[model samples]
Target: MPSNVHSEEEWARLQPHITKLYSDEAKSLKEVMEAMERGYDFHATPRMYKHRLQKWGLDKKYKEKEVIHMSLLKKQREALGKRSIFFVRGKEVDWEQIEKYLHRRPDLKTKIRAGMLKMSSDSFDIVCRSPSPDPILHASNTLQYTDELLRLLDGYYVSSLSECPSGKRVNKVRDYAAAIRCFRRLDQARTMILANMLEPGFLALNKSLDDLKFVVRDQDATLIFYLCDVVTIFDQRHSPLVVELLRHTYGILQITFGESHPLVWLLRRLILLPEIDRYEVIATVVKAAVDKFERPGVDDRVIERLKCHYFLLLDHMASKGIKTTASFPEMDATSMDAVSVAYLGRFADRLVHSCKFEEAERKSDLMLPWLQNTANRQHAAWPDLQLFYLHVKAHGAFTRGDNKVGEAWLATVDQHAGRYFPNM
Candidate 1:
């Protein structure tokens, strides 16, 4: 028999059977062409086959593909359960009957008994559906169900930091954290998982928190806060992870609430925890960055921006009379302050640029006490000279009734000009 040549009798006999097989499986015309080439026998009349295919919803181009292999069918049956149909070496086989012959694992048995898993006639039909009847409640309940599933899976899958490579564990933890974020129940999720993690897992959890800090949504603030609370609780027992988690959570809070936000107050308290060296290293690093780098486009600026943010938070706290032991030295022009007076002068310049005359004056006022204290007491030549010059210029400007000019002069003198003036 030639490939392209066929008798009318042969065509009439085979075409109908081919159409019936294609129609039974809902295969499209193109799929039918491909299947026939793959050895499907067509034996019925063409018209009857076409009518049957259309009646069975198999005539459309988009109809689902036919299952032609038993192995593929068996795998799907195991994953999706006994309701699947199988075609074993071109012969149709019942999936439910096959399951009866195979021994199931205890876990699989438990899932079947608990209804956590289900069987379906089609793979698509095995999808988890909402238990809620009401549309609004269904959406909420669906989220809750997803959260529980992740929580359950996390226990078995999320490895401890010590038990796995740091990179792999960190990635897993971050993925779990992200999953928790999606369902709006991160706090409950964290609480459920935190109870499972021992001391060693804290490091991985901290790394996960660090990774998630940037992606946290506003709705996750409570979760971030809850993580911070957990860190605080374990601060003494697990100083390193606690510190890292606190830092990460603080960063998240800063982004979500901005510097002047009250959440910063909570962060300040966390930063000042007793076991943590809040003032010595972390505060110093923050101060240096804010004073040096956190401006418009300096590439290495996150540390500095964070530092400046911390300073603004401190300023906000002071304005509200929140007595915090965490103190940073004021920047002065002539004194050996942590930051140079030249920088203070620049900061004052920015205040002037913003047309913040009063703010500029207050900044100068902040420097005044230091200058006045230095002037009235024993001081170094440079500081004394700077203080006297600042006083003279401030007084001269005040006398002239140009308060803004006076404030600018005061800021400059306190910051730089005083360094050139000799003590009078």
Candidate 2:
């Protein structure tokens, strides 16, 4: 069997299966190949797959220009008080890139809306009728529109960062802060409008709020830290925007100052923002970062950090009884930093609370060096380690029938309780 050769009988047998997977299920070419091998024990070369797909008219992708044309036509319909929906091969267009193009070509907007200019392509249809089960399609279309609007807003935010003059970023940021408050009000109004209409209105609201968070990340490298602190103080909630800003800050500092930079580690820990069932996004990002740094011969310190965060996130989710299949990665703690150690300490404390004393004790022993160091006591995570160690020691002593030692450790925690938790 040559690589490019495929028999007529084989194609006749597998053609429908391939079409179902490639078109209906929307799997990529590689994924389709892997699925075929696993499910049908069929093996084919890429060229064979491509040739068969072309011959059978299974190409589902919209060309870049076709997408541009569809987007423009869609916008043109919107201007004329008519809705124009588009689908390329049974899926929606990539609204993000289309929105970027619309933002980049403001001059074309007037010509397009006024019907003076148009783009023609055969790759899509100007769908006049609504999709079947109209309400569901309406909700989806609403979300798609909201996401596009949010991206356009982000583009404006990036422009503000780019167009600001030297020595006046302070004023510019101050104005931006004020503008965000107004934007929030407008967001509230938009939410109200949708809330009156449908049950999935809050989904749109959440999407808008989530998208607003990444706007601050488009800053010049120098102003990242200052702007991050300001935004943190300005919005006292654990908002998605702050997490995205921290992620952006982490990338910049990791590149400019290297992985060993304290700010990099801080941002690494701070960047953990996993939504419900969306923790894989964090894992994927961290793994990619690990690959990027490893390609340059960097150590696996970042992996240690990722493992700690992953465990802590799992613990947090477990406490809420939200189960996930994400597992803790195997980690080496020989050179773990204070922040990473703190995350492990927090995880250990959760284990202690769950009555997993033996594992908690092991974790305490792992942090013994950092716990005993006087200088480490001044570190921010020192109290977390201290609390974890004291709790584990008390639990261990009580289990071993050494009541006095357990009481002593308990006494130590009570003695320092005020200092460790003054507000509590």
Candidate 2 accuracy as lDDT? 0.49
Most accurate candidate by lDDT: 2
lDDT of 1 by residue, 1-424 (tens): 3244446666555645454545435565566655665674433344544664454333322112222223234334433212334343344444443332122223443444344553444533222211221122233344343333334223322322214544543222121224222221222223223444332233334444544553444222123223333343332333444454566677776776577544444454545434423322233333332443334443332232233335433432332243345433354334423122322332343344335657555655554544456443343333433443354445445544789987897687556633443321
Which clashing pairs does model 2 show? Answer: 213-241
State the TM-score for model 1. Answer: 0.19
What is candidate 1's CA lDDT for residue 234? 33
lDDT of 2 by residue, 45-77 (tens): 888888888777654454434645776666544
Which ranges of candidate 1 are over 4 A from the true structure? 1-203, 220-227, 233-235, 255-257, 275-424
What CA RMSD would candidate 2 show? 26.9
Worst 10 residues of 2 by lDDT: 170-179
Q: Per model, how many backbone clashes are there?
A: 9, 1
